[model samples]
Target chain A: MFVDFLYELRERGVKVGPQEALTLSQALGKGLHETTLDGFYRVARALCVHREEDLDAFDRAFAHHFRGVPDDALKIAEEVLQWLLDPRSRRELTDEEREILEKLDLEEVRKRLRERLAEQNERHDRGNRWVGTGGTSPHGRGGTHPSGIRVGEGETGGRGAMAISARRRFRDLRSDVTLDTRQIEVALRRLRAYVREGAQDELDLPGTIDATARSAGELEIKLRAPRRSNLRVLLLLDVGGSMDPHSEVCERLFSAAKRATHFKELRTLYFHNCVYGRVYENGSLTRGPRIVDLLRECDRSWKLIVVGDALMAPWELTASNSPWSWTEEDRASGIAWLVALTGHFERSIWLNPEPEAAWYGTAEVIRQVFPMFRLTLDGLTAGIQHLLRGGERSR
Target chain B: MDFARFRGTDAYLTSPELESAVNCALALERPLLVRGEPGTGKTQLAEALARALGLSLIHWPVKSTTKAQDGLYVYDTVQRLYDSRFGDGDVRDIRRYIKLGPLGEAFAARDRRVVLIDEVDKADLEFPNDLLHELDRMRFRVAETGDEVVARERPVVIITSNAEKELPDAFLRRCVFHYIEFPDRELMARIVRVHHPDLGNQLLDQTLGAFYQLRDVQGLRKRPSTSELIDWIAVLRRAGVESVELDDSLPFLGALLKREQDLLAFAEAMHRGRRPRA
Candidate 1:
């Protein structure tokens, strides 16, 4: 039975094996489950399911395996069936009670009713107590209690156990359905490029041993700086306007980049529809550093990432005297500035939140100046690989 | 030696599921891998279990630079080099310079202990994999002295992770896993009462209402967790604020929302009388 249950879990896509099964059996042997079905559920889940997303699958498997018997009342069913079969208990029934008892199919009684009958020993023929055909007791047939488990019913046996697994409390935790910040963070980890550059603190054991052996009877020590990822990231985010619909994914990406420890330095700046003259340091766009100064400050070593939909009026990217340009000194068009920025950075990529099927107009124009990839797990991974590769000096 | 089951210490409260997970790990002698949101008392679970079981706690806090060998032992080659050059004592004995780490100490101890590998995910991805052999066998070898140190009694191991990184499958498969859910209102109230015994029900209700509402606000970079809620209550009581209204602005918003963006988002959300768009 346990092996069948294990196969059921495996069939439902939970990654369980013989080792997990052995652990479950060992836990059961120790009497950890206390011989209760609910206890077994907890123990089996803890032993078999290691990931939170796999919980729903585990629940489905459990419900299918156990059916409707209450975890703690599996033993009581047999004992209660015997008590219900006893003719001595039925002998005390009144004529009206015997009529109600005759209506119940003795062989088709539900497990829950039997368990409840085991709990209530005294047969109270009337008044909401005991399993006798009567007034509002959940057990026994011909009772008028609302939503109570009706005895002598065969089809509703699975409802009790099904309700427990049907809750599916962990549905939100499933990673395949949503792109959370943690998943983005994991994708961002591929951007790490480790280069040993720091204070010489870590012991170079192999170097020390080699030096000592060469010196012959002389003690020598070697120290080298620990390897640290020297990757510097400059994230430019386009906020507000058409980007509002994609803000959730963009925020996840922004937060993931901000929290990522792989890079030696990470700087974030926000822009509106397009980048031309300046970019705001804060999301509200009150104050910002000039684009020219920022370009001069950041060298080619920094990998530049621009996140935007790139869907805007054509004039915004082409015309220098467009209404969106804030200052007279900002003479270059939006595309010109983007080209200059992309040209200055050794590695640069633009992430478009808009799906590939929707890309056209300004998005197509932007793709010409910079390599554009969708803002997805695969897209981010591909963009990171592009940044890591040594072939491209500039787009 | 017999040990009592961990029911939870006076200051800590565990749900039935978490309590059972702890007991199952104890019975099977497998490491309990605990993952949860930050400030959900992941580290405190280990301390609570040790206290409840009447065992001494041995904490090995893992950092990004931490290696598996660092948990077992560290051969003090520099110290030996210095001693050979300047000290009168013989430096030929490598045992003098060999130092046992937290895991090594736990193995060599006379009594069973609760060993906590806190934030194991903070280290490299291979960190857990490196300790698989020692953890499975409860023994390690000190290569410097060529001596094998085995456990007198297997220590109860509890590993915690913030889900910063995904742990390897092999390491996860060998352990009992539990994800500590964020406490609901009732459990949160009980936990708060443990810290603030004198707090009134009205104040608790208003603060919790506002706190949960703030968490529900969209586009928050970081949500305020249980520890922040406790701190917010502490700040409220310190200022002698009697009645906090759920409709009104919170008294000590800084105590709950740590990030600047979150505070701004909360204010914008409250000002609009609706949840802010992401």
Candidate 2:
């Protein structure tokens, strides 16, 4: 059994050998005899694998060797195939019905869904109440609902559901498509503050040669490290919603910032739509500490870089009692907070993902806060230069 | 094989999954692959496991330009050429120029040893793939000496990555994987207690709350890690400040938050009356 598994791994380009096979056999006889599949997987992986790249191959091979032919019905591909075959059966919900459904509160929809499920007798079709297909039901697939717990079907269209009720592992809506970090790295290079601040341990080859010659070949070597950049950058990246299209570029920027050793200090934060009373560390920002707390604790000397499209509903930037806020009490507008941030940081700029021409027509609050620059290499260079010059620009 | 024996160690904490993974890796003579964010103790786990298992650790820190072969052996061809041309020294024996690297040393050790490949992600993409065969067989061919150096006793290998680059899937398959998640407030408190036993609960609690608050800052690229926390506490202890006041710890913020931006933002927050509770 182990030999067949080893054969499978080798076929998958795992590079397993006799010694590894021998060890595996011994392991199976001892520690792995009564272990669970996960334990077996761990042991087998350890014995046969050496590189992380081969993990997927090994997994495929192991599944093939142990589990036999994979059942297509267990996969989403099967469901997709079925959906394609029965394409004519799917019914589209009317616009008026969708509008009415959209007005239903999420809690009320959930309650109605539960009641419908309890009363349901059989598989339903084009029904309004029971959990089934092609209906105004908020429970099943091939149907439309303003807000729903879409059970047992893949998403066909955006209109199929307004809100997801059940916990789900949604496809990473942020494309995560990548751009070459090298270009971003080059752009970020301009943002350095070239000032020597650290220990001089770097060897000066030319100086060492000259000094050695000057000292009558006494072997005296001179050391000089490149002046460390004292530039401290605080980047607040906008994520989610409209920013989804720009994820790849944003990621490239994030990666470049993280990789750049020139900056003495670089920090990053995430926000969605607009900066409210808080900012978050994670992209989803479902559960993270408030950004305002950290802002209050900031050093004030750090250069602030706010990266976002600056195209959001005016309410997000100016309304004290916006929908985004969890509290009933009126809070200060996002513009107020941003204004405070600009005042706090001596040198700061907003790097707009959108073009320079677009900013004039975008939200007025965005224009009111800081000098907005396009998110290009040239724009970055210009922004950094503005920061280096160190004065408040006309807002 | 008995992980239970090392449970009481104050230097490091091991989760059940990690304990199992380590044991499995050891039993199967496979390298363990650890992935985590920076400062999550991926490298420390290797050191701790080595100490716990009573094995001599052989460390091979990787750089971006590092090759897989550099971990096994490095042939001093230039030195040999220099010796042969200029000196009367014997350069015919190639073994003299063949310096065994960390991996080679681990393999050559007669007793069981632990090999730590730290920051494997820093290496070029090919590095992990190139080591696939050598690591699987626990042997490598020294081209200079025309000898195959095999492990006398299979050395336990622990490979850590910061996930800087997506590692080759083949390399990932050969190892038991573990991700050390960022320590929560309670877990961090426990970790702090382990490091500083004499610290008062009130002081530790206050410090942890502030640390979490600081870490929660949205824009911080690098938050204060455990080691930094330890350093901060040590600095505080050295300064002999007993009351654990936020104002007193201002000067030592450099130890906790290295980024100038983080330091500035922290100062702004402190002045803005949103400071952590005393």
Candidate 3:
């Protein structure tokens, strides 16, 4: 089996001639039988590993070529195949492969191999140049150039340089490619392992019949992705003034929230430190489109993360929009909108960039409203984590 | 150091055993299953391969909801059911609207591609077995029909598991395996330099020293990942600061640790890094 394995190497372009195979066979005869798999592997590997790379490829090829050989012998073949496989096996390469590997580089090596094969043919050919074509040599070609200058093709002597150049070029031109990493990240994100369907919920037939007595057997309970109670945000962002020191942190938290809020729905409304009857998205500002849009869109499906240090005048939390909005609807009792916005979210948390101690001085009204909205002081990371963990209604 | 001049780039890439695993994936050749620690770049290996190899990366993010078809191709459950019941074969070409799931896209890819089956451990036991048939044969059956489409060649298959859970033995048999480890400090620093070259050496030293100190402490829920270090620098840049100050640096904590408790614990440790005498 081992001898046959060596023969396979030659066929695969390993240059393992019969003599070397015999020597390996004799080495095996002496005392290699009881050797560990590792031991045999080491011995074979030393002789076989060339190129200092692609050992895995060589091992794979070796394994495939020697499929069911005994373990020790298989290891030996693996070593040999690694060392020998590179120069042989493949007859042709794709155009991209050739281009990337630079086809011209192999011109030297291929030329040398061809020259060597031709010389072997010639040295033996001259001695037996007799032919069957009405007394003529096979190289005759109707008596053209006496020595068949076809061998005189290129003007290089050793052709060793040519073959070497070609091989080097081909090796050098190998495309610099690796597997796409994003695909893996994406795969991990959307990974679904099973077809999980919830058992059907029993229907309340009597109630349905009462609502539509004439219709009979009206609405039914169904299986779905499940009503995922999600998140919504009425962000009264302290966009300017005293908020400048913490603006960077706020922006980053916003970024994280946008990305991390994938599981449930997230709708955001922006305010300048205080709530008004109106909320703004882009440039448009109308009272009806306030937190109510978020409320309707969310349908009690979201938790609001209002990001700002609730640190303005008491009146700012009350009737007036301290930062000033011209609309009469907004200016009148902005505090009503604040209370309404809090109700709009299933649960709302105040992510104050300001330290806990600093939040105490905020409008007296805010202090009253603080515990009501489930407000708390958390830095950027904590704040985000709190939202992701699902901001709840009080401890 | 100069990435452009490494004339032997492929040689170096192959020098690492994992790189070979990556190359096999590129040849559309075979599946590679990597088992490693939580952050050992096992999963990231696939993403990197996709980018480096220039193959269209179709990702089938695996989870509990993950199924073989989910991994192979996206199936619109609501729409498919709706059309099947109401339209009665009269709907538009569903095959066109079939929404090729990441795994299915890889198999269907006319060009060479990489399909990442991330966190196979998160999936059910049957998920791996279900995948085995397609993986072994390099082909999958479309749900609508019994037609089996083999890949133009195999996609460089990469399946990463955080090792929090174990995958099935059947899945293991169908793949070429490698276990990636977190790069050592030296490698970590190298990675840092690769990703964020703008940081000054002095600031880099302080940040790295802080990391070393943090890891040396006890009972912390998490340690910073290479990715987090980049985020920290980005924060510093965004803040218009050339150096990372000991104060106001807590926000970068999220990038490093997974849990909120870990961040608080890490921040507490940072105080000790500064006030050694205390």
Candidate 4:
């Protein structure tokens, strides 16, 4: 039966081989059950991949392999043999072959093919998404129905429990947890109302013409796209010892902030324990030309998201370190530089995952200088909501 | 979300990116090249693919000294001798025990498995050039059986590299590439929750913050990975350090940072920056 299945897949131009058949049989034994098509799908996936372009051929092989079975093949076959056996597809068969099946009173053969053909037609009309249906499924959003759909769930009566448990868990799987802003889809909708510059409703051309007749053969009008932040973002991450705990969260925030806004200038710099406003060279954080270059290049419109817990030891921000010890400036200028940067960014906000209560006693000096932009940490939910809302306000 | 569906005790064991890469592999039929820093689960991709797909896991941790044959087949002299001395049995049975090396076994697998050619960068400059055909053809030759094993289509293949230097253009052309960056804070928190279920929320948050601060420093040769921080927290928890104190933090530094030079660099960083308690 397996041999016949392979032969059938080959006849349909699937390029099935010995190793692929092994995978098919394995997925089948693992339980191809009621959802026969879905079972073959898992098998097809495991055994058939060779190149990015060969996927379509693999799917065709799977469909043809399970299209139909002859009565003789099922007589002495194993239970899984049911899967190996399938209805012979008249789609790939010759006219002569169809004539034979017709003689056997199989009227549904052509009807099934016609139905598949009609479904194929429907797909092209519906944006051509299914591979065999002659469409694309980028992001895995489109595909033809498979033989089995629940094999991954397991092979028993626990389907309800299995589904319930999976649904109960995995409900909120955030790929990035950095900035806690709304996803692009959701955030875009909120900002759409503010997108006032979308090329003015086809220029009241007729209105201008109508006005020309009344006025001195001329028209005076004004138009605008409204203020938009082609957006510029500067990301400053606190790396090294102090940020160890919030590293992952910071990364997620960084990822989200990168994706969320359309910044005109985006310069992400990594600073060690604290941002002395110095750059690193030869593994040593030093005040260098690049540091000045970054500062000199910046404009006030850029939105800055500093992702750190901001729970510093207080002295790092308040203490007076030597100016020569850094570069270009003394400890006084370093503190002034930070204060200057904070004042420069008009559309900036800081996102600290640490709670407000935690920061209350630790780094009070930081807030004393730049209290406006701190990520007001009320709690996870409220904090994220505020970040998203603030991002919306900025754009 | 259902980590139970994940493959192992580590690597793909609890990672979302790994899951996406594998699913992408199955659906697209594309060989994936995953890159990241060391211990960020580059090699674990193949291991997870093997477990998730339910097949033999064939691994070849490519060393700088690896030869192409190192991954294909190896003769089990002792087993062959045993078979020769005992039942004088079928040579075919002995051939089965002479098991295929990870990459070779993946291709020669009786059932389709996920083959991980780990640390491809460690392999010689000629490695990818040599693999171009087998990877493209999805087939290999088995000497014991005198058979050519073609893709009856059982294995999902994932290759990983650290990109210590650079790979040839030929390699980049043959596979789909993805960079597995370090996790962000939220994902890191989830990971901490998953791995160190015993850690308190407040302590966990502080430890995560500490790690990020460490990463900010430009001195360390290697930054502490998400897993390492979790390990550090576990050590601290075990050592009875109730808070993120500097003395407690210093002892656990070994788990967080690698390279003695990097550690020295980290200590120097501690000189003027904020201390753990501060």
Candidate 5:
């Protein structure tokens, strides 16, 4: 069981070696209470897994090998495997139909959704009227929801979800990802703004020396408040599965926003793909505040730079289910939230990690809402330049 | 060990699961890898555990530039070279230049101790991987002295990570994993009581309510942590403020909210009659 579990974990990219397996075997020989699954889990985890990322894989492998074989096991395994293999589900509706549904009365659909939620008791999937995945339900995700709410769709294939009927917080799991500082420094240097914020007592060495000389060797001192930069930046970063690949660049932008001495006030928040509903303060995403509340609270004077690939499924932007999770809630579409965000922070620009040439299809749709810019040096410069040129001055 | 007395003494409360996990790690003689958010008491766990277990604490704080070798030992080759040039005493004596670092000292200690490797995630990716052998073997050889330094008694190692970087799976396999999540309202109240027993219930309730309200604010740049709550209460006490009125809590918000955005949001909310207009 132990060897098989280790092999399975290794196959799943866990990097388990013979030495670790050997240690596990020895540790097991010393007698770990295996009556409870938790005991075995702790022991195996200590001996077989090393990385935090690998814990998921280790848990999967352990569950497969040790847990009692049940009918649901195969079903769950297949589902998890499918989710891993291809996040975006196959859409049945044509472009025209989806377009028409996109134009449907979202408010009416939400009213019907509340009625269905109050009536429905049991869990339903791929069904009409109730919330579930892979069906022509007006409430669930991964299915057709013409004038309906999307409950729990994972990977949206450009389908504009009407509204997210459910709400749940998914953590920005890619916090550990480190980006090269070189590129970040270069990118941030272009957007540098320096202004004296406040002064502190500092010796004016040049003036002191000149005064001392003029006073015929008499001790002289000059005190002046130091000039500090006064730049306030509000950076919103997209993090999760879609943003995972672009983590390095996102991290670079995030750290640069924080580290840059010019920025007297630097505030960063994490969201997944689009800022729907809320954004997290920390990478862990344990705590979140509503977007509406934030927009109202934040000072409009702060420069807002939103960083994301802008490559999510169309429905994630236009439709109901949030890109973050599939919990039932009467919330607006992700794009609606984005528009509101831009409206609040007039000096806002979206930094796209994906290449400019790739900005076709769904990316183009997002570009329509947010003035998109490439995350590279030239792109950031252009974006900053646009901001400096008072592009948002009219607003 | 009298954990009940220890808990009362340190004012550190633990869930039953966490207590068991710690006890289990101790029983298995495996290092406990405690991961949590900043100010979630991951580092404090080591101190509490050490005190509870009646063991001396050996702290080894890791920095981004810290090397794995620095934790093991420091060989003063420069000093030895200086001595050779000056024809000083004991230039050839390797012991003169050998100094055991925290980890090395933990292994060298005759009595069992608690080794707290704080913020392991700050170090280079290879640092944790490199320690696999030393941690597993609990012994290392000093090439300069041609002497083998072994553990007289294996110290209970407590490693912490803020999840800044992912540790190597190999290193993780040798240790027990535990994550300290943010305390709930009840737990937070208990924690506050432990820290500030004299604080009025009404004030504590008001402070916690405000703390949660601020935390729930959408688009918060940074959320106030548990430590910040304690700090806020301390500031309130210093100011001789006995009550926590909704509008009055605005000024004391500096102790809770760290980020400019958070501070601004709270101020805006206060200005807008304690609820965001949007």
Candidate 6:
């Protein structure tokens, strides 16, 4: 039965292996589950399911396997309940009797219970000779044996277990869904490229040893700068209008980038729909720095990440006389500015929150200007990998 | 050796599932890897277990720069070099400069202990994987002295992570994992009562109602956690604020919501009339 449950867990895509199965069996052998269905559920969950994302699948598997207890098991459970509630067997034990009961180890009691269970099979065979009511057995409930291990008291009803399993509390934590801040952070960690730079502070042990040997046994210490990530990230976020639907994901990416310690520097600038003359430093779309100056200040070393849906009128990218143009430099088409920015940054990628199937119109044009990838986990990871591998400077 | 089961202490309340996970780890003699949202008392579980079992607690707070080797022992080569140059103590004895880290201390101790590796995810991604062997065998070999430090009695190891980085599958397989769920209303009431015994029932009810309602507000950057709720209650009681209503105005909002964006989002959510309080 346990093996079948393990198979069920694997069928549901929970990566359970033979090692976890062994751990579960060992736990059961130690009587950790207290020989109850609810205890089994709890113990099984802790042992088999390691990730919170896998918990939803585990719950589905659990509900499928233990949909309901078999009739015979329920009958035995009822009989066990009756034995536990027998009034005549509730007498208080003397100190010596309690001491003797305490002397009976838990493992010994569990072994005896197993023996009784194997020896007695029929319902009518429930007697003092087995682990049944009003007996001096050290395993059954409400018996004369003080300190007896309670078999199945305080059981969560079958329906209650189903309800608990159906809760599926960790469904949101699954990686298949839209990225959370932590997931985004994990993806962004690939951007790190550690390079030794700056002041020499860390001790160079091998160098010190070599220097000491060269100096004819004179003690000479050596120090070198610690290895630090030299990756610099410049995030160009499209905020306001049409991009409203994707603000949450964009915010998550932005926050993750801002919090990422793997990069040597992270700079965020906001634009609407497409880049024009200016990019706002803040999310409110207030004027901050000119695109020309930004490109000049941050060299090709900065990896550019452009985030937008790219679903706009074609004129927004190519029109020279667009009314949205705020400056004389803005009159030079949006695509021109985008091409210049992408060309300046040797490695750049555009992450569209929209699904790949929906990428058309201006999105396609932007893709031509900068390699576009969907903003899902796989897409983000691929984009990071692309950034790590230096991409062509788009003309 | 007999192992004493840990039923949570008076100050720390644990659900039955968490208690089961702790005991399972104890029975299996494996590390209990605890992951949860911040302020859910992931680190406190180790302390509670230590107190409950009458063992001393050894805390090893992991930082971003912490390496797996730092947890075992430090050779202190620079210090040895300094000593040799200054002629302080005998620099030939490499063992003299070897300082034991928290994990090394836990292993070398005469009695069993509870070792809390707080925020294991703060370190590099390979940090947990690096300690897999030492954690599995409960022993480490000091390279400088070639002496093996083995545990007299295996210490109860409790590792806590904020789920910042995904732990390696090989490391996860060896651990008994448990995620701490945020307290439900009844549990929260009990927890609040533990902190504030003299608080009025009506005030407690209203505060919890408002707190849960605020948590339900959509688009909140960060939902207020258990510790925030406790602090909010303390502030309300200290200020003698009688009622907490989830309306246009929420008293002591700063205590509940830390981020400026979250406060703005809450006000916007209220403005949208999503939460029309009766």
Q: What is the TM-score of each predicted model, taking all chains together?
A: 0.63, 0.47, 0.41, 0.38, 0.49, 0.67
- Over all chains combined, what TM-score does candidate 6 have? 0.67
lDDT of 3 at A106: 52
Chain A TM-scores of all predicted models: 0.62, 0.47, 0.37, 0.43, 0.46, 0.60
Q: Write the per-residue lDDT of candidate 3 for residues B1-278, one digit (tens) a residue.
A: 11111111321222244543343233224476776556556656666666666666766678876787776665454464455446666445667446767766777778877777888867654577787787878777777655566788467777777654445544553455565555666766666676677667887776776666555656676676656666777776677665544442744655666787776676676676679756
Where does model 3 exceed 4 Å of error? A1-395, B1-15, B24-28, B37-40, B73-99, B244-254, B258-260, B267-278
Model 6 chain A worst lDDT window (10 residues): A156-165
Q: By summed lDDT, which 10 consecutive residues of candidate 2 chain B come out lowest? A: B1-10
* C-alpha lDDT score of every prediction, in listed order: 0.78, 0.67, 0.50, 0.54, 0.67, 0.78
Per-residue lDDT of candidate 5, residues A138-194 (tens digit): 223333332221123321312323233222101111111233554455456556455
TM-score of 1: 0.63
Score candidate 5 by TM-score against the native.
Answer: 0.49
Which candidate has the top score in lDDT?
6
DockQ comparisons of all candidates to the true complex:
0.32, 0.12, 0.01, 0.01, 0.10, 0.34
Q: Give one digit per residue, the lDDT tens place, for model 2 in B130-185.
A: 99998999988887677999999888899998878667656765666766668888
Per-residue alpha-carbon lDDT of candidate 2 for residues A1-395, written as tens digits (9 for 90 to 100) = 45445645755767664346445545554545234556566666655665456778988997887785333222323332343344221222212233354454657645654555444434354333323332221223333332221222322322333232121102111111232565466567677666655677866667866876797766555678667777788899999888888888888889888987778888788888777666777897765445566667666768899989988876677777666555443266777768878888888898877666677534545766788877776667678888877733412
Candidate 2 — which residues are off by over 4 angstroms?
A1-395, B1-8, B86-89, B245-251, B271-278
**Clashing residue pairs, backbone N/CA/C < 3 A, model 1:** none
Q: Give the per-residue lDDT digits (tens) of candidate 4, residues B67-147.
A: 776676676644554454464667457565555666666676567667778878676556777887777787778776676
The reply for model 6, stretches above 4 Å from the true place, is: A2-19, A51-64, A70-190, A193-200, A206-224, A237-256, A270-274, A279-289, A307-319, A322-324, A349-395, B1-3, B141-152, B164-173, B185-278
Specify the CAPRI tier of model 6. acceptable
- Model 2: reference contacts kept, as a fraction: 0.20
